[model samples]
Target: MASSLHFLLLFSSLLYNFSIYQAKPFNPTDGLIFHVKKDVSTLQYVTEIHIGTPLLLSKLAVDLGGPFPWFNCAPSSSSRLVNKRSIQCLAAKPKTHQYQGSNKKCHIFTENRITQMAIQGDLVEDIMAINQVTDGSKTGSKSITTVDYNFQFSCAPMLLLNGLASGAKGMLGLGRTQMSLTSQISAQLSSKLQFIICLSSSNGVVLHENGHRSSNFRTKIPDSMIYTPLVNQVETPHEYVINLKSIKISGKKLSLGIEEGKIKLSTIVPYTTMESSIYATFTKAYEQTATSMNITRVSPVAPFGQCFSSRENDGTLVGPKVPAIDLVLQSEMVKWRIHGRNSMVQELLG
Candidate 1:
């Protein structure tokens, strides 16, 4: 009920803001930023981005593996992307069946298998207003400015909004495809591209940074930050996949028959999942280690097969004092240590 009420308030606020909008492009600044939040019920990470003139606010679900971004837009004769030479500046035009609206207008259809739905919508362009935070060395604090980015997106049908968080009008694609938001921005920049996603318990942030003047921007390093090179596969061209060399439990390597070729990072998924065989081995190993420490096991929960008695005195500041899991990446040098803080889920069962 709380989630429902929150969604309604957001939707109502959007309607109020949409009623007043002016068509005037703001001169774009150096950076573009998106403020993010996590949906409690859906477990989907969402971000807010203002679009068009006067910057109408739109909340979109962040889809890290999605190929392109789209929104559930109300049908209007506002504008269309067309030219005498080509459709959306492409050499080839879309066939009649591929499009929904008309010949002159172009559209990009994307499907979300998790929701068991597809977005068949028109390709449109709008000014995306992003709040930029720059180094305000003189002011002794971070200075902020709203940067303008001419963004290309899909104006999807109303029915396509089903199964998504109520207030999320669309999906924000962050995949590696050409139509993805980052790829589009990279095209505009015509330089090397690198983006950052920082998720937190509070409000998260996403930054679209340009690499042209690489020398100018330097981020201070934290020793705790782990690094791994991303691996690209021929099969999944649009996914950001990483090489996972092995898995360890309390510094002891687990025996495995197969090595997972790559692991894909995603925010849409609430928890980490593994292949059936690998998962079976993982749970067995965890249970063995946990029992060795005299930690009593409880009735299993849905989705999570291994359940523990949280009432036990064996607890830490972060979570239950259990064996830590480590994901050995490309090499032994880089291992993502997953402490109890990350691996345990405390559920208040009645």
Candidate 2:
């Protein structure tokens, strides 16, 4: 009995020391994290990181921005917490082109601006042009005044949580609780740059509890859609207005945005709690977005149809089902120029 007591004392001391070490912050190169000790079934928090050169100082305007209303809107059978943090990030770029007779020559000139939810970090999402446009135009040329816009957003990947892993113990997490995004315009053309903005994210979560260790039970990257520009010639401002159309993920209709020199879309659909079942809504939303956000809703389709377990009569699926969610997106630009010194003029696309 005495020996057993001594061993128990030593084990308690080790656990105490381990808890102290866990209390310290974990700054991984990937992203920041929030660790909680208590057993919680649901947790929500928010953080924002910048998305540009670290030292480059410039103000951005949010032409339009909002939080992703839906995120992992379902419950888990294990000791895992629920999360519903919605976040949106947006950036804009401009392109210039000229039309010459039967032969139409085009050049795409662009500048990038980023905006996102306010969070407590200095981290910024880095962006680089997949396609460069330096050779499109020359400096100091008398070119027509038009701009081409590009947008970018990053959804930090899941942690592959230990709670969901084999021999699990506890769980920890961080989410985009709430956010607002906008675009900053140089003084001169701010007024004329009118904007009609919309922001959304078909955000969802994949939870692993219960040690259901199947390779299929992994977090999957959600489906995403964006406004793609087509080649066209423009002479007046009227010709610049491309008809506003819907952005579909998979095949479901998702939110969209429009402004001169810009187009934007949501990665996922918004959350509406008034509905009967969050899970059902999510399943349907995923399919629609996957179909490019334009399809009929299909629910109680798969796991629901099954007895939930091949062996147990508990009516629960042995494996978890995670759908491809919409990635968060934001779009903004001034509809009309705001009278001021167009600091944007100093922006060199050459």
Candidate 3:
């Protein structure tokens, strides 16, 4: 659990530095910036994307773990007029597969095994726009400058996500695969093939297309930001893997079972979801630490394992004051500190 907590701590610290990178000079015509909207109920960030000739507004989940962009669309007479038009123009042509390797059939399953969204139609090129602005004047309404591009994307006819992905209409994959949006639009970007996602309270998230380069054209990294080399591409071609040394919680170094003459523990940054067993291991250690500190534990929340009773009578869950947790990376002499909201989950009773 210390390792998991430390991972999140490290991620948050990097996110803070990324927030500063978002204040650079951005040309609306050169690069596209999507306005991220965080869903309070699901804690997922979504953005609006316009597709087709008349511009069909569709909400898509900002998923970095996914490899392809798709939406929940079904071909039916009762469907919306915009969707029907989009389907006719996008999927009426001959079916074209967009997967890598020899797999002709493209089946996309979410991290949660319960829901499966399959790509069922031809891959077609269509106009995709982000950050659309409208001017409301007394004369008439007009659209401001928007970053639009004609890109190829999958049109999913059968979407079985149920309510698991109700936070958005579909998912926009930013993965490393060729079918991802980032790879498709790599020619238009000025910097390296990289992006930054900065989450904040003011603006949900500010995503920079070129995060490595500063405004002055100098390649510089912040002092607080730590750099770790990505793992070998031979091992993980479509994922960003990094080396993790160990985790320390309250001066206690948790063992990661590092054997002699073996490679250190390498982990991938799971942008979307992780297994329950893996999450349980960390939560178990967290609960044990809370108990040792004489912190009273309450009934278990649905998803969250560790929960404490609030002092007030509002049935609000209180966060326990835990000791500092550190995540040590094997790449460099980097240790990230984890505390506060990054290590605790608050549950409210209705």
Candidate 4:
């Protein structure tokens, strides 16, 4: 009931917003800088087309924006060449403005897929955990002292994308699109991970969004940065900006202030499959069904921090700290197995 009410409120807000919007040529300056930061990282996942191959390789690229230098955090360059395995996916474009008490005048585009898999990884290391320490005065007087805490850690995994696609669109009688994907993993990867954070009283740590960790494998690093791809962009044509007002990780919490940042949104199409024919099929489907898939803005309220020393004498004023994130994307295969009893019964009846 609570979820239903939330959906109703959200739907009403969208309807009201849509009723007021008038499409016009986009101007970058016209865009409100609702959010700003030293840097922004855009991750792009491209789907390639391959024939005769039974597998799909997930390829991605990271684009840098702002004060920081380029960081090629995406997958290997060779990943771009591999054909993406196809699942049923499509881009949706609505044909009418039926819900706004208006005739068929406006359209909206969205992505759709029958299946997809996504993995995420995280890592954190060399951090200080401060604790309050109390000590007694030497003259038999009462006194309070403070102590510091330290911990070290790292964890990684492949994550699964389990989402049922159900969103409406405006295009003709094409209607809405519905599909979903799942993740699978091997038995070898189920082992428990030990997260350790090495701490010290002397060192100061800064936490911010632009920080990053080094690649574990030599092969994943490139000699030179590969430019952003020309095709299979994940950004959408629509200009929708989103700001993360709040975030919480573990037990820690933080709020996003105007000085903390602003957001400028652009829509995108994330390539998730690897078969040429399947790629074509899903792309066409997604385009056609853009009106119905439930593309949404999910603000993840994860814990993040910015800490530095006011005193240069202490190990403060250093750069931001990079924490690692990891998740396992279990492989899922579309299998068709015949039942022995049903097969035998059919044969006997024949």
| lDDT at 41, model 1 | 77
Sort order, lDDT high to low: 1, 3, 2, 4
lDDT (10s digit) by residue, model 1, range 1-350: 00000011010001000112333332233345566787887777789887775557888988877777788754433334533235353521222453334466664555653485875566777777666655433444443466566766777776777767668888898888777787777677664556777664434666676632331122433346777887776876777777777789988898766555457777676777776777788889999998998888988988788998867746787557998888788888888777786677778867
Better of 3 and 4 by lDDT: 3
Each prediction's TM-score against the native?
Answer: 0.81, 0.17, 0.65, 0.15
lDDT of 2 by residue, 1-350 (tens): 00000000000000101111212221111111111121112111122122222221211111112221111111212212111111212221112234356532111121111112222111122221111111111332111111211212222212211122222211111111112111211111222222221111211112112222221211121234234342232422112112223223333334322222222222111111112233345444555433452323333333242111112212213112222222222323211111112100111223
| Higher-ranked by TM-score: 1 or 3 | 1
Estimate the TM-score for candidate 1: 0.81
Model 1: runs farther than 4 Å from truth? 1-30, 75-78, 82-102, 189-191, 211-220
- Tell me, by lDDT, which candidate is best: 1
What does candidate 4's lDDT look like per residue over 1-350, in tens digits? Answer: 00000000000000001012333332211111001111112212111111112222222111111110011122322221111111211122222233344322222222222123222211111222111111112333222121111111111122222222111110001111211000000011221211111111111111111111221111123556322111111352222222222222211222222222213321122211222342344334332332232222222232211121212212112221111111101111211111211111111112
Instruction: Tell me how far candidate 1 lies from the true structure as C-alpha RMSD in angstroms.
Output: 8.0
What is model 3's C-alpha RMSD? 9.2
Instruction: For model 3, name the residue pairs that clash.
Output: 1-282
Q: Write the per-residue lDDT of candidate 3 for residues 1-350, one digit (tens) a residue.
A: 22222121113311212121222333532334566655555555667777776677887766654555666543422223223234333322323435566543323333321243343443445677654222223334323345666665555543434443354666777666666677666644544566555443223442444443433111224656777665544543555445556656775766544421111121122122324443555566766776787767798786655676545323223224665666566632776566644555566667
